[model samples]
Target: MTDTQPRTGAPAKPQGFAATERIESPQGGGPGRGPMVGGMVAQKAMTFGPSAKRMVRRMRPEAAPALLVVALSVISVVLMSIGPRLLGHATDLVFRGFLGRRLADIPSDQLPDAAKAQGVVPGVGVDFTAVGHWLALTLAVYVVAAFFGWLAGYVLNGVVQRTVQRMRQEVEEKIHRLPLGYFDRSPRGEVLSRVTNDIDNVSQTLQQTMSQLLTSIMTVFAVLAMMFWISPLLAVIALISVPLSLVVTRTIMKRSQGQFVAQWRRTGQLNAHIEESFSGHALVKVFGRQGEVEDVFAEHNQGLYGVSFKAQFISGLIMPTMMFIGNLNYVVVAVVGGLRVASGQLSVGDVQAFVQYTRQFNQPLTTVASMSNLLQSGVASAERVFELLDAEEEPVTGLDVPQRDGGGEVAFEHVAFSYDPDRPLITDLSLIARPGQTVAIVGPTGAGKTTLVNLVMRFYDLDGGRITLDGVDIATLSREALRSRIGMVLQDTWLFGGTIRDNIAYGRPGATDEEVRAAARATFVDRFVHSLPDGYDTIVDEEGSNLSAGERQLLTIARAFLTDPALLILDEATSSVDTRTELLVQQAMAALRADRTSFVIAHRLSTIRDADLILVMESGAIVEQGTHDELLRADGAYARLYRSQFAAVEAA
Candidate 1:
């Protein structure tokens, strides 16, 4: 391949995790209530079946409580459903007394017992006692229904809380099992969004939507059944509206679904852009690209507005359209019931009950309409979460790896490796480092310097050949076992939020305070720590931003010294320090390297002149290997690199 051409490697590909929308949360916003803009504003249309099924399977443990909630909800709704029918009887009793009509073609036995009782005025009668009795029964049913409703909510909340906690735990555990390559390829913000935003979406849905959905569904079926029982004619009239409402809902959703998808996808893209722009703000300003950056942001903002407006507009139609259709059904039911009542084909009480049932029927339809967007957004978030959970994890092969001898001898025997198997980066590479020797590797950028370090750490499995440490195959060793015996200090230092003392003792978590201080002193880190106001107790913020780059490097070196591992890997460890600090660091490093095997990957050829072995690499292969002076005498790749660096320094 030409230098400018790209090379394809592995034919095998890892599963692609879905990109999630960047939801902008309002201050103190809790889950579903959060004010989302951009991607969150638009709902993406996608099938939620797989994700929903997976969630249901995972929620099996909480099935009993869910079922209990369902049962309670059903009982509460059934009691409430009886209220309209009983109230109608009370209305009919009063109407009968006023109209002076008792015996009709309808059977007297079908009438309530209260209606059959004699009135005080004989023909011109009022059944006061019967009305009171009917009123009392209706009130009792409602009171009991209210109690059951509250209990159902209480049980639902507990179950949802426990289930959400379990989901969060699983996601955290999954994070630990994912390979380092996954992190390397994926954006940290995107991954974070899944863990926090997407999971939170699921939690909110379970807590709020689950109950509402169950109630709406049950209410619809109960209302329909009651309507049919009252009069099949009015029930048919209500059923006509169902098809019309569904048609409207489906049409609008078909349009809004795509927009929702666009909104969320664009939202993720917009967030990624903002993150990149902010991170590289200095670079943008230095290159006078502020206007360009603004233009880019404006373009993204405009795109979001267009898609979100469309999505909101389309979804907004659902409630109003359903409402209009439901009212039309209501009008027809009322007119037809009135005619039937006048003709004595239906009783006044039956007409009243049917009207109430019609109104109740529309209620669930309205609820379902209003909840359409929330359900869509929730399902979208769920799918994204499930995608993450279903990602491929690092396999654990519990093979018995023989323990390495104490010598720490390392060897690479004809190793053939490639980042992409289609194009080999390193072919038939061979190297050996006897115990207690300092081996320096110098190479240009893209020469696979870091790749070598990655291999030694077993960050990626080798495609072919074997790497042995003291004659024990590294592949046979567990990653934890192999890595525990090695200590590494890289150019890009990392420090967590903790005290300076804690950072120094990171590699050896069990080290006492004195042991930590001793390690720091050995690395000359104590010199700086003592100068600080808090000394060893000084707090280091995340990434050690409070400390200078060189100081961060110093702390990492101290951490490595604390472990005193058999094998040490230093990658440009002193590149950040000044000349004076560099000299001191070098002195400390020399003492630390005593009787320990070390591999120093350096750009500064001068620092490794005294190394027992120097491997000069170019294009992923070592072109020269020898003592520094011996390589200089040979006048090859190493000599040219050294001469060029020295020339540049002298010229400057």
Candidate 2:
């Protein structure tokens, strides 16, 4: 996504930057700029690169520890590889010694006539003491090598686990620092997949794939070196398989990488669909669209399966191809080594060692080919993760304009806004709420009542004009500082999964237990809370499903009360509650609104009859405004709305 600069209080035009650049200066450079750059430059660096480059950047400076571990692991693998060859040599030596002993056991008279003619006896043999001493030396070498090999594997595994742990922690921190708008545009499941699934894939790649790859590479080199020491001619023939196997591996990797990318994308899509379905299960059931949702989910599931199958199928071919090449190399080495021994150019021991080296070389190749699939999957996952880390954050820039403390006066001057620029939701809207006054905004759905509030809160910057709090332009103040003085209760109460006391205290985190209960009593929520099984200590389920809608609304109002904010916003807060509960909520609201600036967006005209000023809004603009009696005398839009509500009440 392209990056746009944060708008300034002055009328100067703002400048834009490339998404990859760190916004060091505000749109228009001035005083009161933020301490750090607007967005993370390091995250952007990782966004566009190969998997290896991205992985290296993601590891950060902490990778130094992991690198040291990896180096030690490589050394261990080398020692282990050498150890196996040493053991094989010792086995051959033992066999040869046994052969000599067997010949010595034969009687001198049992010698063949050809042996007698040549003055050679079957019973004659080399010194057993010398042969035993040589065998002991080979066994010692074998034992030492095996010990080092085990040590290497153990050390490397620890390093791999620790490195992955650090990486996961860093990724989670980045996710939290990203802006709210980023979450708005992206699917929850897709974001969650990166944090959960992508990190998991990378961990597996480190723990299993990288370890196997390192061991295989070291073993292959060690075996090839031993083969060259034994028989240079056989080594030369064995080296041919190297390029052949590499070609096969490169082809498989190239084909598998694209499939892996597609597979991960499909997996994310499937996860997003599943999360959407579950979150909206109630709506789906109410609409009788469960079958339709099932069909859509099945389609996504099948798509994921198909892509995963193709990715795995291509990667799965690498192992068999390497094995085929390995078998061919083995036969060639054996035949050539046999011929050389027959020509008396090589000893039987040398031929035996050469054949063993050839097998060892093939074994590592098979291992590396097997690990290619995991490597590809990890690379794909890293690409997705980096994409998120690289996303642009919201702009934060402006001077600190001092606001009047607890004044609670809000004024909009010719303000305009649009969810999309081409379609304005509010046009040239202007209004004012005096200190300690209750302003009620009345309108049909999509009449921009909420949009007006959003602009007032600076949730979205105005396309035109300005919004000021206590005569100070809001755009010039810090968003966090300004929002702190305002308390909002939305129609849909979002109570996090926590104890009732904790949710109430969310409005003022440091509030005492007595203070929390006082706030609850002011909102008339204490009665219901105390009646619960665990009273105020009861744990609410997700979205506070354990409580009725009216109780949830009361809890939200109680939370707002605890904050004791100068400006309180109740946006259709009592719309869903029953009549009796609504009356209780109104009584609580009356108590909470004492000496406070309040804005109530009410559908029921009765709730707003006592408001100091009632604004009649139509199509984003204020059509009429006056006190209840003044508006009723004027017989304007407010009068019509009041009469309509009065008629409805009388009819009921």
Candidate 3:
């Protein structure tokens, strides 16, 4: 059968992601892989409940410490709440003493009839001793309350900081398990935002808002209980304002929730644009698109500003509205309680205490209403993080077949695949590479040359077909086992932040200094590396900007050389270097491929002229296959490709 089967139906596009090649920034901390574009599109606000439960579940390891934080917070709020009531009692004592002194000034027969009828003793003196005792008790309560508050803060900081540290670690680990396709479709900025920004939001909430939330909620209930204990009549009046505050708070939250969601999403977009701009600053200036870039940033920034202002302005109204209701309650309490006091049914001190309680009751309500926005923003951040943690991971559950030894054999039988299945890019294509053979893959852009390499590496699974290595179906082998036998060097070279020696030893970690140096020598990296002052000890920054592009390519070659895999795939491996370096790299490749199976995807047709097998592909189907001489003799697609490149080089 031919490589391609006849079309049956149109291809279906994949959902939730676009088909795009992944781009890695040479600058460190550039846009990361995430779902947002330019990091600025307004995402739908996620529900808070599930995300909250997930975080609580994840933080279970710190349960004991978290519980301790809650206990301390509760004790602190209780202690603080009691301080006001005790001070109120002291006020009552002082007021009583003043009245006693006044009564003492009058003779028993001359005393007011109401006082006499109420059985007030004549010639009574002010009780300074009792007043002093009340003052001391109030001071002690306040001091103890302050101490509890300090202690709670100390314990809570430890718990929150530690929990956030663990959360960051888990998120880092989760990124490694995700599939390559996820990165292919998502922007790097959005991913970076989640790892750094979103996590920080959750961290800040834990540190500043968690204990405060508990304390504010508890304070509300405690103040209400004290109000009831003092006088039920005034307490009932105070209660009327609670429902009013609730209605105001609910209205503000409903309006502000959508704004908060939009605010965070726009923030992410602004970040994405900034990252993209910085990384491609040279390109922006070359194209004279700086103004356009600035305009886009302004648009995103303005969007964020509008939403954030609205959310804050709306949520901001809660405190004042609650305070106004509180003051209104206080006035009513004062007026009615004064009448009761004049009738000797209530003391002036009791009225003062009830007013304080009413104020205290409003304080927590205001804090909680304010906290609602912060909590929502925090939960929104948490949803992004949880979304990443919950992304579909690349599965690794196949049988653990042993890695093939020596030169490897590869075969693709009726391979069918596509980035978006409905738009089939490759169909029933098949090819084979015998042991110790060099297979050269050539095709126009989007003709599935890289896709073929991707399939062979199992970076993606096939829709229909089995690929075999050493006569064993690869599906039966664990991904680790299968990939362990192969080595690759791509056009984009990546190096981590470390000493040169460390990076060269990355592929075969724990490789000796001698072995690393030997591999570097093989790839000709030693020529430039040894000339440097630090030699192999030089530090490469996060982006590897310390080295030139060609230098980075040399290091990656050294890394792959150290692996000594049975199979090697090189996609435009020597495209970065000058002609002189290209010759050196070709020589190195020739020596490396002497007894190993290799696949070379080359745009420079001349480079693969010596390859044992040349597969000239067009639109995902192999149209011609033969050695260089045979292909020129056939005068087909391969010959035309060769003639075109030969003419271009001659003209240059």
Candidate 4:
């Protein structure tokens, strides 16, 4: 790729400059493409059964609201079940009223009772008054049932929302507790998809399934009770379809569950592909990778489409199939009820109630069966979320040291570490920086220079040994307490969307306007700010894309200066700026370094030459350590690097 992204894309592999090497901290990546993109990396995702149960258990904190929703659902279903029976009574009244009119000419008692054994005497005429009363009661029952159903739905919404809100907060907090190695090993897109897309899917799934599932289950049981009460013979016929319904649901659920897993897995991959492509778009174009990127995107898209279609298609068959089975049961129930009514053993009203109960029972079966799709998708997303919450977190520090009030002494004691257990990096390395010393670290790419500074910041814990600040073991200090008195200006300059003045003051929150301007002037940020139309008030976009590299770098310098920290770690902080601006920043940095312990990482030729100590590292160990002149006198690693590097620059 001919074009290089400004430290934001996965840098084109450290092309002979510290600028390109900025993100090569063995962990951090530009944009969202972190070092490793392990799909289900390093761990197996939880299976559906456990994940579904876990999802339900996550709502334990919202138990009160959840219980209320359950109570409402029961009330709603029980009320709704009564409506069918009342309507059946009205139907019987209407039929007897109409039939009685035709039999008016015959004497009353000699004629057979025409109320179909309902206990009403053979009538001389229609009874419109009784039918009206039954119809009114049915309407009132239906109205009340509808109200409770809506209330249940309303309460379920809040319960699901609060549960998801807590979930989002936990995930956010977990991100901070994870070790830098986690990001080093997992792609940024994969993590984001789990955080955002997967969680959102969980919310939607719960919203769609929660109240409806409750109502369906309640309706199934309650309606079955009424059916038995009306007629045991007809109820038994209806019960025959229960086993058939269970078999269909269980088979389809088992098969479609696997499809859902594949569907989400493919979604994560597609998201990763899109992220890497967009972050490195300039490189892709420079290398004519449009077709390659598109082809890969197409591949992932097709994979997702195939799995999603299969999952949805399989789940969709449930509703109609269940309906078909219910219809068959409906036929048997209706025929049997009609026969009982004709034999005069059962009243027409009772048979009418039994037929209505059959329809109500089947409706719930259809509903619960169809909801299987949402349930599968929801559980799949829940498993991914659980995987993150279950990730091993950084060891929690148990003690807190007071913040360093002045220039701090930092020491690294026999530190041993590695990203992978099999491949060791930075083993048994040791060093110390006295208060007010300017210690410079110089090395080639992958020489463990950035790894050294990272140790001081505690980005990764040592596999062995300890780091101490001002005689206090940092491992005993809370991470925040230890980092409180330190300021870092990395080669990768970052600025948020804020005023230029605010960006500079970020180094020290609550600083006065006067103090902010002082730091800005000291770092030459004010020099350029005055030339712009909005000056300090101009709003910079995220990462300061509107400003030049040197401008962004200077603002970061101002931020570090504003803090006036006891210890400073500048990792190639001046590499992005121009020569004149770098010189000014070095002077400002020199003043800033006067009483504070500062660790400066840079190429030997670029750093302040009057450094009190210089360390040359190779293959994760320091091969040489001394002042610049003393190292040159030794004619060792430092001397050779300077001779080779400076000699080439001089010739040019």
Candidate 5:
């Protein structure tokens, strides 16, 4: 209700769009229908390394919490790594006690030569107390490790989620600051995907991968240290698998990274397609293009499937490949350990611990390799979000200029503009509207009728020249100040989900109930509201689809009425209403326009017949300007347009 005008300042028609004229630019231009997926394409293309680094920086704000997570992960892995060594000791004590109990039954001298050479103690009965102690310690180690692991993941989740929340806020603010021309070229659905689907994907990918990745990496290092502690030679043998795992994982990631980027990019395109197709579903049925739409959907869906399968399949190679290398390394270490044990160079318990360490070392390598998919997918999404965040913002200028009291006198001093620089839409055009005058603009479809009004509203900054209201340049005034004095009703109605009274109240927040009804009565809306079940309380759907076109237009007009602006604009204001209601709206508008400057852009000659002044335009310049009767007497472009329009009606 507070900000009815679009921040982009895209023009609402002279009539139907009451307040939301600024916003409809992107939504108005259906997302691009390129032969390929360009609508949702990233503004800037990026690769895994840079995008990943940027994502890391985004989390820098949560460094303290992130460090806490790392500390926990380190503690967890180190504690867990100690357990296998303890278990190896327990195994040694049990073996020794078993041998001692058996040997004690015989005399020491009568014991086997091997037992004597090994220095086995006699009369030891299993040493249950010692074994029980070792077992309890190992249990404690594992339980603590598990606790730390859980805490690490919990803290990491909050850090990543908070970062994502900030990213969303940045995107929202950026959307408000982006220029209208950006949307004119970009697809609406594509913009929406970046904000909604892309950001969500990024959040999911980061939360799922970050903590697990930390733990896996830490486990590798911790287990390596323990392995080397047991025996340098065996540790070196196990170390061979590290480089081999890296080689395999790196190769697979390089191949899968491109596919992951394509997968998310295709996802954006698919979303854009779905959004556009469904938004205009009625038109599709009316034109009988359902088969065509289905074919396109199938094309997009198939592309996504193929890319997704490749990304997953390629990243999927890491786990099994790493495992194969790990198992091979395990075999080499086992053989070496057995030979050393046979030579009495290593103790039975030490060899046992070394074997367990090998597995612990290889396990984390495998885990990190397996997680490449989520990491790549997340970085791919991060790049898309970054592209949006980096888009050029509208320049903040004209703040040094001053303001003046409103008299509703707008002047164009040699204004020049174009949708594209080479293709001018308006050039060196100048006109003046005195206070209390009704200025009607009539032109062919591409005659710059809407452009003239948009310039006055400062929707687009001028390439040259200046426009002023009450002798104060509009560019100097903030968009907020300029728009506050102007009210508009464009050709297409914009109504959000709200009660009838609320929609009107959007024009003026905190409006009294009586004030709302008074505006409704002026626009002839009150006549129909009471017939509905809730009268003024009746709720309208988001698009106001439940209401007839005329009723929707009337609500918008009533909204403009409540604003009571110093300047008014109506673009085909009565285009939707029946002739009977058109008269009522016209009367209401006249009362509203009294003592205020009003601009009307219309094609209907009868509508502007009584205007104080009329301007005729062709291409990018005005060809004539005068009263309607004066133009009729002159028999120029305006006269011909008028004669043709009425002639067509007579022929019908």
Candidate 6:
């Protein structure tokens, strides 16, 4: 089949995630609200409220399994904590036995039977055998707990990695579905960092911080319970420090949150600058602006470094402060318990157990303080990602239009458009092309020729008026249904990093190898393909950099031809080709245009001389429209454009 034969079925429209826009409220409101109170609440709430909730909601669906794994790991921590307290109890027993012997000062015959039988003082009750049994049991529990802890960690890591993978995939899919305008508005490096660096931060939190946080919490709870069981008075004294530690942690986090956000923003800026510089390195070299660019980069890099240093400096204070508080609690427990034991209010064993419990209680607090930094960083990264995911999508509301059936008859009626509504790009533009007719759009730069075609394809909605395909409004049709009947080839071709066959098949995924080869031959792409070492299997590097401009354009033409759409658009198709290549491409285009409606945008005036109708546009309006011969006879805008091109050709 020829390139003009329309393929069956429709191409799927890109899918985008749903996002809602809403103004968030401050922390609180009351009947007696004041301006100062409201301002403080708003500031505080903005930092820790809606943004955080949004991030968690975006991440939680995928992170559910990981969260479960974390909970399981927490359970293992609790079991392990039990072992530590048991070890403390065993230690207390040994200390008690030694203390009893020293305090009794009695001969072995005077000790109780049980103590005497074990070769101890007669009236003094100290069981060494019993202590040894308890020690062995504690050791066994420790071994078992350690084994489970390792297992939990191993499983949790796998779960977290998988969760991260899903999140990355979802983000990638969402980006693909989003309108091209979104990318135009956002910096490339900033978007990329959200997917890469930000996701990596979340992954770190999942794999490391999450586990540590769980373990720390479990340890604290278990240790606190054991401390209370041993001695309520000592437990109360140790617990007094908990409130103080919490206050300190809260203060540090509150101060550090804004700094962390600033740090992330600076990092994104630095990444953006680096990416922009590297991507345009050739331009920098050509313009002799390498030194200027380097200076710019250094400024951004320094900004990032400063922000990061400040954030880390603040976050790093938490762990040391926590440790200091923990040590103070330790001192209080020691001094109080020692006084109690001297007064005969507590046994040596009881005092030793309480000390161990105090140490255990502090362990989780220290861990939680250390992990706070990572958790906050992850939260910041997640917020960035959700910001993108929460961006508005293109409108796709109308659904009353009829589907096209491969007969391309496009008409624009008083179409107007503007990338920004305040500045109109096209105004009151009208054009039409009948089925099986070829139309050439000739215009000066910024005359809205490309915008006209973009309207027909519904890339951007018209600000006013309507576009219709086969007598049906394009807006009423599904985007996929409308675009399925059209094929486009542009001067700047983009080929993915894959084999030539793969690239060609991308236009029609299910196209047979025979059909692919036929399309290539029709476009004269086979000649170049055969010359390559691997023919159809040859790999094209990034953006088809391995091929010449003309060659890349031909490959794109081949792809468009392979799709076999009823309507073909050649937007500056011959702009990049040499004279010889242009002639070849023009001939191939003519063949592809047969029995189909085609819109040609040509700088080379000769290629479109045979078009059924020619529209000469200037300032978003068609200044002249007629057959090529009639326009030439009229000596209007089309004639001037033709003459200018002819003069340039002769000069060349």
lDDT of 3 by residue, 28-128 (tens): 22233322234232245576667667766766777887788677777777777777777766776666556666677677788665454334565565566
Q: State the C-alpha lDDT per candidate.
A: 0.76, 0.71, 0.78, 0.80, 0.81, 0.72
**What ordering of candidates by lDDT runs from best to worst?**
5, 4, 3, 1, 6, 2
Clashing pairs in 2: none
lDDT of 1: 0.76
Q: List model 2 lDDT by residue over 98-125, tens digit each.
A: 5445567667688544333333334444
TM-score to true structure, per model: 0.87, 0.83, 0.91, 0.92, 0.91, 0.86
- Lowest summed lDDT over 10 consecutive residues: which window, candidate 4? 1-10
Q: Give residue 295's lDDT in candidate 1 (0 to 100).
A: 85
Error of 4 at 533 (Å): 3.3
Candidate 5, residue 432: Cα displacement in angstroms equals: 0.7
Q: Of the pair 1 and 5, which is ahead by TM-score?
A: 5
Candidate 6, poorest ten consecutive residues by summed lDDT:
14-23
Candidate 6 C-alpha lDDT tens digits along 1-652: 0011121211111111111011112323321222112111011113555665654464465466656656666666666656655665566566556645674766655654433322333235557787778778877777776776777677677766776787788898888667755754456677888889998988887678756766777778777787787789888999898999899989998888777777777777777667777767777888888888878778878888887887788889999998999899899899998887666666565677678677778878888888778877777777777776666776765664547475788888877666545444565666778988999988766455665676777777778888888888888887787777789887567788999998888899899999999999988889889999999999998667778888888888899999888889988777767888888877888888888899887666788888998888765567788899999999998889888888878999
The clash numbers for all candidates, in the given order, read 10, 0, 11, 0, 11, 7
Best by lDDT: 5
Candidate 6 — which residues are off by over 4 angstroms? 1-46, 49-75, 100-128, 398-404, 643-652
In candidate 5, position 38 carries an lDDT of 38
Q: Which ten residues in a row have the lowest lDDT in candidate 2?
A: 12-21
